[model samples]
Target: MTATDLPAKPYRNTAFDASINNPSAYASTLDDSFAAIDWQASWLCHLNQLGYISKSISQLRGLKNDPAQTEKLEHTPDIIAKVLNTALQKHADALQQSLPQTKPALNNQAQTLKFVSQNELPEGEAYERFIGTTGNIPTRDNLHDLFNGSIWLTFPKTKALLNYYHMLEIKEQGIGASRGRVRDTITVFDENGAILVTAESSIGKALVDFDWQESLVAPRDKWDEPKQLNKQAQAAVYIFGHALLEKLLHPRKALCAHSIVINVTQDFFTLSLSERINHLDQKVADYMDALLSEPDVSPRKLSPLPILGVPHYWAENVQPSFYEDSQVFRSGRRSQS
Candidate 1:
């Protein structure tokens, strides 16, 4: 490869407390676990470079200034809300929304935050009803909730739209044992949704048609910053799932995302980071808007994307042989004549 073929940036992670990946802050340690994360494993250090990833790290202050303060820096709901709110306010008005303050773990309830009495909002009102009507997200202090809150900050519009649809379902079905197809689709996407933006609609079609090699392999170089996955390039993945983000913290080859495909113009690759994020935010929200417009929606609208196999996101994929793992990169849902 010529000099021009080389990527402009190198892998380096100067910020973010790696220990924040730990599920609990209560763990005692001085063993350099804080810096042990494989920050540079993703090409161009993409994982380390995500702006919201660091923002979700609430313990950065205590850990950076003094490792001893790990115990002192508890991620209470109020703190997590403030952190999310501060991060959200940094964006445009569309991204701006008030985070509900964290309520203490009342009546010996473990791992709870920003909660209300079970008697507070009728019997069946949970995730959607509480958020939609009471305007309060019933949460408790915990790692999982933190990741969910992080996603809300990242994709406020999409999250709100998901809640809106869930409320519609609840109104129709009344939170029965069976959530019906539409609710199931909303839940699946809410918990593990991602948006894959490609300049070419054919590329998106390849993924939807389960043309794994065509979408993931042959077009590998065409992905965002093939030379260095962080820079401006063709396509990008915007992860909107909080659970998926949590799983990615300790990235494994098996991890995947239920991805929504949004094809954009060829010039998309040239936009700034903020511009891309805002554009994807609006784009995905618009897609979700149209999706929920129909009463009968299906999770099939989302395509399966083995997130690790995304171009340079995982180092193992640098060698084409990595895609040979059929368990991870399956052949397809293609037809039989």
Candidate 2:
């Protein structure tokens, strides 16, 4: 019999058709009759929708075109779910494999904590502990994960140094307080991007003295117009931390020693995924010389600066009520102390 004339599979069964109404029931009906490649593609699409998998539309289409396993099968929701679970497991395995073999020692404690894989970090006590002590762990296959993985690979020492300080804070202050402090010092919001830093002793106080409320929170008629908005000072404050951190790694002209901000324009998103990764890789390499000169892996004595979400990327920023209930833009009377 020709491949096209092969007997109908479970995917084409009438029971499968009726099971579509109840996804849980449908998944139980799935057998090995369904083509593996078709199932994988369907499952990936579902993952993309649920934010578990991050891939460009073009890449996803390419996966669907796998010629080796071509069998027509309707993509039922249940089938998609099964495929997604499989894909997630595979991705988790890959991530775990990519992690460094030597886990860092924590809190003068000789016992080392296993590096939690991305899939296992969404919930549970382990996730909470990881976030509380180590800062944020990026979700697998997402842009944040990609960037974070790059950061870890490029600046293993600096990344570990940051995590050590984060753990120390958690040990001293409770997780709640420690997390708040981390939000202030680092940009956990990968979508908008973040700049983190420790200001030089001389300029630290001055940097925090500005009236951020009046400058960043006030309502404006043309919020989208960059020129119309008076946010340079706020921008300076936001980027200062990142600039300062970079400067510490590589000290250059004294005049240029202070922090500077790098804006991620809309153009940045236009680049291909590999290009985006390369761009950031090159940016870090530019400062590798300075980062290498650091005397040791010990944590630097630095204060947590204010955290600023990327304004340009925030959809709410264009609305009139953007700053109305914003915790970040709220008065700093309590924080200033």
Candidate 3:
């Protein structure tokens, strides 16, 4: 059977789907994105949210500690509990509104902890000996306590891949049609072997530079002047492109790099049978040929050096309408627009 006839992969995520339906999903997703990319922005956003919670808790704790506020202290936990409960309820309502309605399966068991709910302090008589000098926050454990639960932790690969895809889409076609530039394109595949994301990047310089000097003089009497040579930055653009596809398909496995070429002419791009086969599946090669043959302005297809893995999508497949008119140029049979 042909590749097109291959059976579709099946995925099951009933519990996860329901869990994301809660309002806390937004907070949790943001938290996950921060940890996955190690982007400081995510943590800063959470810190801002936690700051408000910390301030409210501190004020209440102060009132509870004062002897004159003994009556208020007695009511503190209940008030805190009510506030947390309301927040959680609001989260649920928001989730319900945002997500398409779907019946929850009885087997769904994902539980989210409410920050101000009745939580018994982690207790044990042995704590006096084993707890060490590191004390629980001398002040209330506002952010500390909230982060300990499993829900607050990030899912590494899932979040990384998702964020990568989200950023890619935004970079390509702006939020609508006119706002964004298509630079470089990336496609990610699940280990399950299905494509997860397909993205295009706007052409931007990703370059590294270095200079090395060597003596160039006759040895006997005259001192030689040092000469310098500058080399073109080895293109990471193609390496990342090839590696991304290979990793998505083989995942955690390594593959040797291979060279392939596409030639761009004034009107059409051309690829030899061997060059086409080297970079992508035969079907993709055929698709690329059809794409470049269109009447749109041709872009340059640079000479291919050694790059690794199967190409999931060709740069040319991105419709020419997405790029500026002046950028079109041809090399071999490929168009680099």
lDDT values of the candidates? 0.60, 0.32, 0.24
Q: Give the runs in model 2 whose Cα sits over 4 Å from its true position.
A: 1-61, 65-117, 126-138, 177-183, 188-337
* TM-score for candidate 2: 0.30
What is the per-residue lDDT of model 1 for residues 3-56, given as tens digits with 9 covering 90 to 100? Answer: 633432221221212334543453322223323333333422322123554534
Q: Which has the better TM-score: candidate 1, or candidate 3?
A: 1
Q: Residues 169-203, candidate 2, lDDT per residue (tens digit)?
A: 45556656245434233323211222221112223
- Model 3 lDDT per residue over 230-272, tens place: 1221111122132323232323213322222322221111232
Better of 1 and 2 by TM-score: 1
Select the stronger candidate by lDDT from 2 and 3.
Answer: 2
Candidate 2, position 28, lDDT: 26
Best by TM-score: 1
Return the TM-score for candidate 1, rounded to 2 decimals: 0.71
Best by lDDT: 1
- Candidate 1 segments whose C-alpha is farther than 4 A from its true place: 1-77, 92-124, 226-232, 335-337
